[model samples]
Target: MQKVRGVVARAKGEPVSVETVLVPDPGPGEAVVQVQTCGVCHTDLHYREGGINDDFPFLLGHEAAGVVESVGEGVTNVAPGDFVILNWRAVCGDCRACRRGEPWYCFSTFNAEQRMTLEDGTELTPALGIGAFAEKTLVHSGQCTKVDPSASPAAVGLLGCGVMAGIGAAINTGAVGRGKSVAVIGCGGVGAAAVAGSALAGASRIIAVDLDDRKLEWARGLGATHTVNSKERDAVEAIQELTDGFGADVVIDAVGRPETWKQAFYARDLAGTVVLVGVPTPDMRIPDLPLIDVFGRGGALKSSWYGDCLPDRDFPMLVDLYQQGRLDLDAFVSERIGLDDVEAAFERMHHGDVLRSVVEL
Candidate 1:
């Protein structure tokens, strides 16, 4: 076992603390990563707030990139010194979903079999199966997808989650095509990514909707062809006006609230797609709508999970795209701080002050 400095969330609604934790050498099929950078995702905040569960003393960080430090007895895919992007879905080939040829929906994803423990020997649950806000972390060898080492870890690590979800929500789930009109609601990190993805996919008109004009300006930079401040105007009406008065070909709801969802439901052309990539709370419910609307809408209502991405295939491709200067992955990195600044980053996140605050290990 090796001791590494890490950030840990001890209790709900409490601040994260920097401390030393034990990371054991890799076991069979596992590897140890020397983490270079990790992104502060809202999901980490959800875990800190006990919104995910009561797993106290949670090891909070997931979206990350690193170099392989060591491999287990049977590991072969990556070697020491290889750069990699860590992922949660280390898919098990024998699972039902895998057998059905949809490994992305694998029911039996794997993580480090051994635990990273506190100094006092208390076991710590790694958030989202990846405890990455540290000097080193242990994960299944399959979780390490090798990518271009030249790419900035701070930029590519964001691809491990939110950015990937947004891009995938557009290019994958939304099935955006050449000349299609696409609109993304909630110009946050994920929503802005969706807009970028649409532009990359050759969407002719990419509309961005949000309450904050600042975010709308950011979205415009990210390839949104039109911007709508939803607070200032009816979002559905505004979207319709932009797409030849027929709404957009695809509408993505990055804000998962019922009201925003309703706007997305109505802000698409006939036979167009609606993709819900935003997350919703447990207590929220959709209001009554005529069943005829669902039938008359005449298209798919889809939900994107992690952009339905296949990491091994997608991560390397995205990194290459970033390297080519086609994807502005670096623009997403609004600020960089150490693991100790996570609590403060959360404060900024709550106030919508930044796109992403990355932690440099």
Candidate 2:
């Protein structure tokens, strides 16, 4: 057993604090990792707000990169000193989804058998099974995907979550490709990544739509060819105008709101695709839509779960792209903050002041 300082949210809507956490030795099929860099993603804030569930005293922070410190019995995928990115999808190879070869949608992912706890012996629930905002964390060995040690930990770590979700939304789920016209709504970290992915896939036109000009500017740096300030104009009409009145070949709704999703549905070409990578709250529901319109639309309306990514295949390839200067992963690092700065980073993210505020240990 080892004692480590970690960020914890004790209750809903309360500020998080750094507390002494008890990390146990890696049990069978598990590993202990020394976290190097972790991104301050919105999901952490959601966990703090009770938006996810009533799991209190949550050990937050999931998007992370680290070095393996030790592994338990039968753990061969990673070892001491290996650099890796943490992932939640630790697929059970025998699960129905995996047996069919769609491991990305693995229905039986697992986490560490033993729990990390508070100093007082209270067990803590880890966010998305990672809980990496600490000096060290314990996870299922399958959660750690080894990547090139030469890559930037802060840059490549983001591929563990938002960045990968956005990129995969475009390439894997949306099938965005050369000569395609693409538009991404919301222009936040994930949305901007979708724009970048579209560009990387050789899309002829990439339009970014957002309410904040700062976010739109970030999208441009990431590879957006055009931007729409939805607060100033109609997003659907602007998308149509930019796509030669035909509409984009693929439109991604990264905002995950009813209004934005409707816009994406109408903003794409008749045979184009609509990808919803954004997550909606449980309280939210899609409003009434014309069933006739749904029948008339000959395109797909899909949701992207973790961007429909296969981590082992995508993570290394993306790190290579980042190292090769093909993907501007560093641009997403709006700021480098310490563990204490997480509350402030959430405020900045909520206010649209930054793309990503990473916590570098």
Best by TM-score: 2
Model 2 pairs in collision: none
lDDT of each: 0.92, 0.94
User: Taking the tens digit of each residue's C-alpha lDDT, what string does model 2 give over 242-350?
Assistant: 9989899999999999999999999999988999999999978886799998889788999999989988999999999988999999999989999999999999999
Instruction: Work out the TM-score per prediction.
Output: 0.98, 0.99
Task: Give candidate 2 misplaced runs (Cα > 4 Å).
Answer: none
**Alpha-carbon error at 301 in model 1, in Å?**
0.7
Pairs that collide in candidate 1 are: none
lDDT of 1 by residue, 1-361 (tens): 9999999999999989999999998999999999999999999999999988998899889999999999999988899999999998888889999999998778899898999999899999999989998999999999999999999999999998899999999998999989999989998889989998998899999999999998899899989989999888999999999998999999999989999889998999999999999998788898577899999889989999888888998999999999999999998999999988999999998889898999997
